[model samples]
Target: MGNEQSKEKEKHVFSTHELVFNQLNEAPVYCFDQNVSSEGLAFSHSNLKVRFPSRQDQFQVAYLNAYLQLGHVDQTLSVRARLEDSVGSIAVIGFGESNTRSHSDLYLFDVTQRKVYLCGDEVPNVRLPVCGDGDIIQFQVDIGRGRLSYQIINSASSKQESATAGDRSLVTFKFDSADLPHSVRPLFGMRSTSVTEPSFHVLEVSRELSLTDKALFDKESIYGPVTLSNDCLNISRQDIKSNCCALIDKVLREGTHRWKIRILKDVGASTCLGIAKHPFYVPNMYGMSSQHMYLHSQLMVWRSYGGSLYSSGSKLSHELRPLDYDDKPVTVEFLLDLTAGTLEIIREGVSLGIAFKGIKPPVQPVVVFYAGCEKEVQLVSFHSNAPSGNNDDPILLKQSGSKRSSDRVTKKHKKRISYAFDRSMTYGSLLISPDGMTVERRQSHIGNAYCLINQTCSTGVYNWSFKINEDQGASICLGITTEPVEVTNDAIYESKSMYLYRSYMGKLYYNGRELRKEFEEFWMPGTIVELILDLVNGVLQILVNGINQGVCFGNLEAKAYRPIVCFYAAMPKSITLLKFEHFPSEPKAMFVPNNLNQGMPFQSNGLSEDIEKGIQRTDRCMVCSAIDGNVVILPCKHAVYCAAHAVVGEYCIVCERRIESIVNVF
Candidate 1:
């Protein structure tokens, strides 16, 4: 029985099919000798027996996933993922082998260099953050593309915990893999003389990686009290005394591009929209820094060069200034034509031609918020007109100049959604109307008032419209709370049971922590506020005055959630629930993929952005090409198979991995 249990444990050990470290009693050494454990491979003055894949499997696409353990980590430590021929490769087993023949097409993460190197060449455009102990490193060899890419993530960052594909925090580099031999092997070499030498623990042998869309804001570049929504395209902040800044993840090196920013509120001069070069200080949160230019609402152009602010910033012509409208929210467009060495500002499709001239390339669009400003902004549209093969191809403006259209789900279902304030859950100060549509806070109540909706949202998409009689300054905290919630003032941020959008600060709070994601629209008087709870995909979004505010929170718990509202002051004005709409189906499930062929590559026609936003699970099955995909592939967690196709293959067609199990959702 003991021997049988040991054999079961060995079955789960991650390794190539050609090598089983636990079965061998003697270690194989070609150079620096190191014994291999079933747990991982440690590189030091020790010998490890690791075998490369056989010649038949050499061209197959595989992913090498591992956790890099840093030892005595500092500027002197280094690690390399080298590609070498399987036959008679001396550098594969040698430590710090300087011979060029053994290190063909190698990628190195060196602490001393402060840069990632691809085959001894410095990787372009990718920034290398500081690496610490227990960081994750993944190497991908794409046989179809004939390319090799390496990605590394710092363990200390919150991004390491995310399973989302195409995470921008990962430092990645890709190069041609054509030079690799038929029996190529990915070997690891490290500087390990100390007691705590870095090691690589094998997690998986093979997997496919998803592509990235460089359209959203870079979460890593954000600083201060700013909150980003709409997949980081919308930026907002609370009324605060300090400034904050954020930028798009893509760098505008060289190309003709155009993007639009819609001001959701009248920010006046408190917010500045502009562009800045690389290596700018973000703590100051200044839009007009060295090599930067910004537009203020007061018809002033803030300009800086060579780390110096312009002496006469307001001297720019008034015609070049952005046009102001009486409407509450205004849309502003920026046309950056690097080919013409100019930047143009457009308002309402009117050209404020050539706001700045003789400008160079390699700058990022930035938004800065000053002290004591309550503002909300969204990147409504972006386009690129650059030709192919440009330095900014990924971010180039589309030549046709088309904008991203809203794909908001609006279809109605057979079941209608209806809910009202739960009188049983209402606080003492709050009064429910006879019709149960309006709730008023009595003037006699002093501390707080609370109310909950009658229905519990467990599945499907739901939208509830709300309206306030007046903008009673900073009086409401409203959002969703988990089940078994009590009527208490401290319940807002206390037990991680609720996610609230505080009208007092225009910010979001959850579990005693202030999230960087804020509500992009203000809660004004007499305007319709729609709270969209998509239980199908586990996301919460807001729409003000019929305009969507993108997703405020994602990956919400699958537990029963109740809508809640709280008033902090005694106000006679009543808050009313206008309407409720429910669609008892997933957004992706309604529309099936055109051609669901088995083993066919999934083509993303810009719908990948939606797929990444919790819509990766599809309803179309590959085998029968039906829309009844309910079975989810285990381990990969991909729900692309229908009931019939679920048991058809031993491997998942999407990720090309062995199916460990299958479970039907819903």
Candidate 2:
């Protein structure tokens, strides 16, 4: 029982930590997107919310990255985000690491495709949960071990798969970082473009190493029947300390490899570990005379080992060494500098002061050999740097030569988008509904038409309203598309998604690029037009006052689209969004580790059945969790309620004062 308890205590536990984001105390630890001004943006190392007044220029991007250079990368790094934005605006939040956009190292979590991407390319036939409206996304990058993972951290939606769940990750991706060490600039950015000044706040950057990252010897990687997880190496049947042999497990390359080998069982005469450029004991392995380069071989002499020259069909004269070492494992480091063509041997973290120059290109077949056929010579940790490089480390990430962290993180309250009619998705008489769940346009006679935002629903059936209150000279085109267009003439303009317009001349558009056909569907007062768009099967149809208009557009390439309503200054036009199934719901990516020192868990994915039922029954404000849940914060478009409780202290309470305006829903 005591042994069992000890074994249980030795097992490594998994826990998350708080992230170090762009902080306020020090200089901005990251570089912001230059295309967008950082004026009204509120950012910290743990949280960030970007917003501003309606100026002439807003950052015309769906999402921007705050590129941070973590000078030296570790085994694993984690980042969490709580995305709050409109539909189709941000498909997914991307974590990229490269010098530039083109021909660079990029990792993207494609929300629409439900696939993770490396370098803008797809990750084959893998499918993961897509971030839905008001969802938290956790992003993790394990560079040394080569892993990237994400998890949806909210419990409100059908796709909520937070760390509190059994999986601990939504979707984990793998990539090779060994080849691209130079491309190590990780950036936090977004997908698509956001016309509105979207606000993002809850975030963190943290790291931790798993148990497998220890520097102890790996028995399986080494050849021969070795002991179970032991550092000692037995070269023969018995432990005779002379002429016994072994090789290091790490495979080093000529130019890009460095290793540190310790002399464990070094015998005085024949037990020594040294550099060799060919397979040990292989006859003519390199097809060269002296195993490609000079080493202590049976045919070569040992006295003159430094200073190079001379080649021939005849055997080349060479040298070797009775290497200097003691019974205590004397550490020796081998550095092969390919550019300068020199091999320097370092002893116990100190340079041995001996360098072999004139070592030119194509430095292949790198190996370290030990000769002790009768004796025993062991190689220990040639692939490591320090003598005992981080042994049995606890649950914490080793930072860059500084503060070690062991604090536990419990996520507090993270804001969820109050899904409703977006005020920013309107103009003139067109705007968000009073209830904040639909888009509405009041009656007007000017030749002005309001268009739904190009970003809304990228995939799935999109159902929208096309009502006509008092249609006087109304030229309204109601269809599903992702184009930002308004009808000035009696026709709909070409675009990327799809559209249908009804004026004196009714015209149907395919992909904003093709104008298919024309019909004479004139607008009438009290006419209820319902546009049903099936984006998945590539079919679009319309219902005129509960009457079906067959299939207007078919076989379309897959893409998310918003409902568009164009008005050419038509008078008396009042249209309200009756309802939307899954159309107008935005897709946000948010992630936050549980911070005990803060408030409640941010996404709260692991609530009890009763708690979940209570949450479902609750209709309170997102910030205060009170009952006034009915208002939309402007510029950001996140709805809220609780009038007196609305304004919390100096910060906007909900969005942390990242907005400039707040309007009642009703």
Candidate 3:
């Protein structure tokens, strides 16, 4: 028995520290002028007048050298940590490096703000229980399972009240450990304002490097203003006036999915339950009127059209009666069939029938709350059947009783439209694969080359995605342009008529100007970029690695536009088309090839010689016969048009070329 006990002791380990100031190593101590007390286990700013250090307004950190072997087993650290505010500066206590520290490597708890942060970004929806000035806090690490959690008790408001309440209140926050650094040490940080300095204290510290059942919850699965249960199935919100949505991280693409939601806090008038495309970032509830489908608690069913881009195509059908919220816990059943494209709602064992139909795949379930609607809902049960693919059939979608059924669902049962690089339209240096799905530039190519998609888009939502097979230090550009726009060596980057997303700077550009600034460069080998062209809403959204980066452009015109890819590289590189999906729309191409005038004569005058020599173009409106011409037509590069005539003309009068776009020469 004694030998077995010795072996058990070797498997389990524990450590404790009194947090004495003198026993702690304070490296580069000049970062702050401080006073310390070993008996009290406290560190604070000194009252002595001295030269202010550069770290005055910033966080100064100190941690222990005794690193824990987190990978071996689960570990828990318990301590009494507290922050005393002096003019709103912050004090932090958590896990990180002691000697050299930054926000990126620190998993810290801000006592002043009452929030937990990992890599400088807040762990969304993790609640921290309210605590008094001083309370016991705990940090648990399960490195083998990639989970980290924080917990604190809700102490009473006063010392007298605390004795009676007995410390029952508790809240916990769980975070993904993938973003955490491998090594960690117990750490504390403090920041001081010029007027007053905040203080941080670790009254006691103890760790048990052994297994524990304290943390096994999936707490990080939801986002927004909501509280979740330990199982992460129940979500609740209260007292928030602004519109917010609790979006689940899971995407149900092609399957028959079913989930039961029990109303814990009766469904309010402002509550809506629905499914939306992933990365739904419409700021206001009104803006959410598009691109998503939902069932309002007020007996209404909303649907996203399979044809149009915006919510104007969204149909809302009124139910005969509203749900009876008087029932303490109303359980509502939601069934979605992607194979047949339908959604049915059932309440209290009664089927409400197919509430919605024609829903596309690749959507996520969401719950929207508005105007301080206090509500609590629990996902009691969830199930998804086999994958399905007939959701896009026009004949099946027309059964939704759509008023514009003929306009919305026109195409018959046909193969999904796929696009590839047009081999005949590519530059000399670029080589296209036999199937046209992949394109590669020759190793000898040292300059830029371009290629256009075989198909063009006009007035519907289209999704095009591609993968960078090999980058080879190349600068890639992906965007759309008019059909007539010339694809010169540098036209993709410099053309005023094209909208481009440049990979080199990770920014959007248009008309030779930067559209938006992005910090992270996203173009590299194996990176997949997806673009959504919503023509009806005039918006273009880009997604990288299955994450939507929001709208890149919001002013697209109703003209023929072809997807263009161009790159400049010193060595050969390859790109492959991965997926393509387009919604049906009326065909409208502004550029007509047969309308070009190859030999148009210019007016004989002193400027005629200069025009022929490419010195200057004409300054007369060929359309309305106006001399104050200031508009330049695209493709043929004719400048003989006034501003008013250019805006309304269908084609350039000089070259008789279809006018894709016009530039005002102000």
**Top TM-score: which candidate number?**
3
Using lDDT, give the best candidate's number.
3
Number of backbone collisions per candidate, in order?
Answer: 12, 50, 0
TM-score, prediction 1: 0.30
- Candidate 1 stretches with Cα past 4 Å from truth are 1-412, 487-495, 571-573, 587-666
Cα deviation of 566 in candidate 1 (Å)? 1.6
lDDT for position 355 in model 1 = 66
- lDDT by residue (603-625, candidate 2, tens digit) is 33343343323121113443333
Model 3 lDDT tens row, 168-276:
3344545665565656666656565546544444443444443231211123223234566534456777654334445443455677878677777744455555566
Q: Judge candidate 3 against the unseen true structure and give its global Cα lDDT, from 0 to 1.
A: 0.52
Better of 2 and 3 by TM-score: 3
Ordered list by TM-score, greatest first? 3, 1, 2
Q: What are the models' TM-scores? A: 0.30, 0.29, 0.31
The total number of steric clashes, by the backbone 3 Å criterion, in model 1 comes to: 12
Report the Cα lDDT for candidate 2: 0.42
CA deviation > 4 Å runs, candidate 3: 1-418, 487-492, 585-666
Model 1, 265-350: lDDT tens digits are 53444566667553232321111221122322111232211111221123443334533534477788888888887777777788
